[model samples]
Target chain A: MENVILRDVGLRDGLQLVKAIVPTEHKIEWCRRVVAAGVPEVEITSLVPAKIAPQFADAEEVVAATLSIPGYLPSALIPNARGAERGFALGIPKLNYVLSASEEHNLANIRRSTQASIDDFGRIVELRNETAPKTCLAAGIATAFGCTIQGEVPEARVYEIAAELCGLGADEIIVADTVGYANPAQVKRILTGVMKEIGDRPLLLHLHDTRGLGLANMAAALEVGVRAFDASIGGLGGCPFAPGASGNINLEDAAFLAEATGFATGIDIEALVALRQTVETWLPGERFAGQVAQSGLPKTFAPIHRQAA
Target chain B: MENVILRDVGLRDGLQLVKAIVPTEHKIEWCRRVVAAGVPEVEITSLVPAKIAPQFADAEEVVAATLSIPGYLPSALIPNARGAERGFALGIPKLNYVLSASEEHNLANIRRSTQASIDDFGRIVELRNETAPKTCLAAGIATAFGCTIQGEVPEARVYEIAAELCGLGADEIIVADTVGYANPAQVKRILTGVMKEIGDRPLLLHLHDTRGLGLANMAAALEVGVRAFDASIGGLGGCPFAPGASGNINLEDAAFLAEATGFATGIDIEALVALRQTVETWLPGERFAGQVAQSGLPKTFAPIHRQAA
Candidate 1:
């Protein structure tokens, strides 16, 4: 069993994309069900301004609720230093902070320049060190492959930023296809460069299925030795900053791909498939995407062995 | 530029699934448009019994029409030795012959036992040798990954058949995920074995998007160095013999993935994207699938350079 980590971001990334703000209670149930489905980690919410994105208004409550699910790690996307402080205060073991490789997208997404975002990441790292030394801070390099506004992002620029993030004490470096513009060649090339520059640091990938290359990119990342990936249950996501971007790679599908390809994701495909029904029922007409949901698992599919949580 | 071949199977595989018998003229137009869109090869139609599949009643006409398209090779599916005689008699350049790796699927599909299919394949090769030595014969092993009926196709089984096919002088040895049950790992593993066994034979991949792993499987195949592939326009196909089988991989999406992943497919993605509209209109209410059609080409896409064809 190859060791691969599939971190579910449905509660955070998926919910944010929905127009109808799901109640906090439903979010908790979604969290519980996904954790029970064998996902080891879940990005429950983003600590952004609730005023700007009302869908994630109950970020704190959602994180708190997910923490109660024992044996599963809970994470939150912290947009800036303020959000990092909030997440750290809430005792999140891991906090994902994002910066865009494209200057225009960085400005458009977080209302800051590229350097400003880097500075914020440094501050967030310092805050984590001071307040919660045990917290793992992952710096996600968004739009690392291509940007909707800026188009092709240079691979050199991504490596330079990844090196900086590594030097600034970021525990993990994540290459994000913010607009889903990455192809496998780009993924392999970028991850090869980013990994080379940030030697020995854990590298994760965040992908969107905007152009339907999400899982392909994930497979490329795996080929290049990336073991961690961010996926959303039912393929629910859309970046408000990056227009036309679809959902993150579907969690169940990602888990299925990983496990089927001989990587042990510790996920129960049948459980996830069963839970997907509940999710579809919960979010009617929400356009949940994934094939295993429609085609069901193959008879040859063997679910990962659970260690009895 | 990486040389990857995308063989369009929209005419043969896609239409065979359609209940309506597409007019011969429309089929001719589709063939012309797809060839103009820059596919190097097109599987024109299946030389099967019209009583069995009425949609391909115009098989001979379509093949004759497409042979006029300059700079692209034309192929047709030959189910048995008689079909091979028909194809070779029509002066087709290449003939694709399929044999199922799953014993159950082979029996169900062509109504022949595994040994009987192999014996038939030998006869087809003899016919090709006698009639048109210039015509290339490709042996496609369906259910190479998994089968709907048998499930979990052993890699050993695929390699054994591929080795036998190679011994029989197959110009190309192709692995087809007949039921789309392949994951990237399964693809890599099986292809690695099959390629090793069929050393130096032109190995191609035929994938279905049943589990949404079409592009992912393509990337995996690419990783393992498979250069030729079978694709259908608008992701159309439905295996009548296999109960849960879906369409072949989308041609435009396959081209997009191949080109995007740094392989020079020689496909004008813009043209293919545009032609997809005509296909949609031609088959109104048909469930055409592919992400590139919905999201358009990305800003980073660079169409492969065509050599004045």
Candidate 2:
């Protein structure tokens, strides 16, 4: 059975837009619970100024707590070279950098132009090499599908940005439908184009379920050979730029898709669903979305490895 | 842009499970509104006895009203030869017959064996030939993917049933995920196999959104040249046998998917959304599901025909 990597970004992307500042201990518990469910990787937090996103004020503390977990592969989001430096100084093994393909969304989201963010990415790569040589630098192009503000993001622009990121020595390339405006056909086309530019570098998809096409897009990505994806527990993480939209694809549902389609995710769906219940109790007023938790896994469900055996 | 036929089954399948008996006039209004939204065909009602499904007690009145609408192709579901005779007597242009691929589900749903249903279908075909030769006979195999009552229905069983129906003179074949257990890979495999048995006959997929894989399965079906699908307005419909599951795939979402993926659906999405609002007012207690109604269409959304123009 083929295996795919599902990275839970609940701590970083999921909590960023949240109003309530979860305690460092609770965030650590979240990391611990998701890891116990056999998630291969986790994005613990973003190394940004406390004032920008008060919810992630304890980023360093969260990172320290996650590093204490044995055999856990933890990553952090880095918006610029400064954030990269923070991650490097903390000895984080993976750092993800994101820039939007849509100009309006990039400026609105990070207060910089797309080209400026691209240039910053180059500097971050250099910083990673000089300071944390063992660190993996993953460059993610946000709004690779389309943008709520810009309306239409050209396929060529996404390919061009990906090629530039690759030239800047990125260890991996990630394409994100930050606003969830992607369809399966568009997902296949853009990922196919991005794959051509980035040869054999590991690729991941970060998709949102804004229009209920997230899993469908994931299926298309799988068909095109993308083996890694970013999902959030209970479908957490809404884009502040796209209003009236749901969050990222549900982690349990993504694992279910992987297994049901004959791929091994190594993640226990029942455990994730139980964790989601705990998460809902802790978060209080936040809106969560996922079907597997409500409907339960199908009776015939068996992991790909089990089916193979 | 290639064209696909979207048949709205809200009035028939969608209302069948509802305890509330929607007024006959309202059902007529639904037929008129959906046709105005450019839906080419609609399954307006089932020809079963009112004692069986009281929600469809006014089936004849609904069909009569729908047939009065200009250029609208209306179809009805018939469970037995008696139902088919009623449809023929009414001069209905199309009739749909459903049998389960799972023997257990067949007995539980229609209170008969799979072989008996097939035999009844054969008799219905002979009756249609004698009384209404121009009427199109669409034979649907429910639980074709997997079953809640009987898990893991074999692929060969589905192919065999489709072949038998074709030999029995079925005008079209429909593969249904009645319990919403289909994955995209299985959808592709089963539909590919069924297509080989029923060559050149029109095929439609009736899918449910129970597990959130409806559109993904639809995408896979489209990849394999399936152009017709069954959807419900506001995603109304549920399997009594599949507890805790959501309804059928949303009509607006399905049309949005077809248009977004470069297929021409000729559906006015905004109009369908408006009708969904009206539907909600009419059926206050029923739970409805759809994303396009909540998020609104993407800013860049243009139907395939308009994109080509």
Candidate 3:
């Protein structure tokens, strides 16, 4: 394990954005490729209703197939207590629960009020503690920076939510720029404030490249001591709720950034680059954006994992 | 004027890579529109031979037309002493002279050794001092980070060259990732070393978005107190000499990053966004890469110039 973690959310986040339903076997293969590329963790699929997101109708099968793969942590996005129950029943080791920081976004996304979601989140935590003590529960604060529906989300509200989630037994907390509305200054400010409010807790960041600040925001967060980030392979995933948001920061690019900035990610970038070809073939005509894919790795770049091996 | 400088190099750098030769009138209009967008500086053209870079055939005419526009400092790329003489004769205010930090890149780029380029740079400085005292001589250290030809460039060589330029009475020193081979760690490391060696001199940065670290590299440079950056409108310009290189960082996105990070760029982002349309029309079929153009400015984004006004 390296000091930094790149949690690949391509299957859950990436697939949900695409209309075409990728075969469950291909989703399983995607997991295997990323893990073989030395990614330690992956959010394999989301336990959402099949009707709501038809692309992820085979989430259960994906989780089952991915869990059989060795040497990688397979996780899933649990939208509510029901999803959490399903994941627990399936014996998944990690469940990422998301709640929007803005009330409007929460209402629009999950059709629930902010307080109602928090109450449900607490129930999910309790269920996790009772049913699967070994499972890690991560609370993701979506739209933590700003929301398209509500415009500017106050940093105070984000900090308060972070404090609340920390108190509510979230083993990990993630600050997300859901609509890609964050800049480096805002990222540094929010990360610093939330870290001050909840001392020494494991914090992760999920940034969208909607306005091209994804890697720059990552650099700012790294400057402020953030070591974990959520990324989607081939830069997949966009906010269907947000009007003009782009996609998640490219995982291979994010891993390349981390490693290039001297943070050991244990990711094999060449393998990730190769996997991108398969992804391209799987989703024909879908545009994938990343620089390493076009320019290849710098000659000076040496993967720490390869060196160790 | 704002605290940060977004010197648009689109006309010079952007058009140079483009195969189509845009009319001189359109090039002049590009300069005027960018200036109206509140950019403080623009590199309007390059004084290179017409046979070598036919796209810049009207360099002198473009400079003559753009210098008539007020508010923005009009500059040009001066490849050698002859080009410097032409720019000075045209009364272009700033002449950006390129010299590669790697000997291999210098020989390949300009058919001269690194030491010869330095000597030519000194001659250009002397020529400006004796003939046109008002013309600012800027020494651009290309491949300051790494080179496609030589692979990894030693930081000491960059520092040595930067210090030499400062000593030789160059008005400005620019560290360029000519092939876009830089990561943030290398950026911070190189910038710190050069700044320490050449204390308190005006240092600018020219970053290529070749591998998509352009904005990220810009943020790293900004974190270490670098304020001036070279950007191309619509992410234009790839090195005709270097293989596998992309374009300069996009000016609109660069301005967006600067303003969002609380640095006052004085750039009217909306105006710039509109100008991108004109650029697209001017260079039809050319692919321009930037996020701000794809996703309009965030709701909370307030242009610093608009705020000050």
Model 3, range B1-309, lDDT digits (tens) per residue? 338888998888788778688988888888899999899899888888989989888887887788989988888898999999898888888889999999999999899899999998888888888999998888899999888989988888899999999989888888999898898878888998988977888889999988778999999889888889999888998888778888899898999999988788888888998999988987888879889988999887876653352
| Candidate 1 CA-lDDT value | 0.86
DockQ for every model comes to 0.71, 0.66, 0.81
lDDT scores in order = 0.86, 0.89, 0.88
Error of 2 at B130 (Å): 2.1
Q: Of the candidates numbered 1 and 3, which has the greater TM-score value?
A: 3
Q: With candidate 1 superimposed using the best TM-score fit, by how many Å does residue A264's alpha carbon deviate from the native?
A: 1.1
TM-score for the first chain in candidate 1 comes to: 0.96
- State, as a TM-score between 0 and 1, how close model 1 is to the true structure: 0.95
Indicate the residue-level lDDT of A31 in model 2: 92
By DockQ thresholds, what CAPRI class is model 2?
medium
Q: Could you give the interface RMSD of each candidate, to one decimal?
A: 1.1, 1.2, 0.8
Give the DockQ (C-alpha) for candidate 2.
0.66
Quote the positional error of residue A235 for candidate 1 in Å: 1.1
For residues A1-309, write the lDDT of model 1, one tens digit per residue: 568889988888888778678888888988888888778888989899999899888888888778878878888998988898898889899999999999999989888899899988888888788889999999999999989998988888899999999989999898899888899888888899998988898888999998888898898888889999999889999898888888989887898888877788888877887887887877888978888878888888886663443
Query: Which residue pairs in candidate 3 collide?
Result: none
The CA lDDT at A173 in model 2 is 97
lDDT of 2 at B82: 91
lDDT of 1 by residue, B1-309 (tens): 678989888888888777667889888888888888888898889999989988887888888787988978898998898899999899999899999999999989998887788888888888888879999999999999889998777778888999998888899998899898998888888999999988898888999988889999998888888989998888998788877777888888788888876678888877888888888888887888877888777898887764342
* The 10-residue segment with the lowest total lDDT in model 3 chain A: A300-309
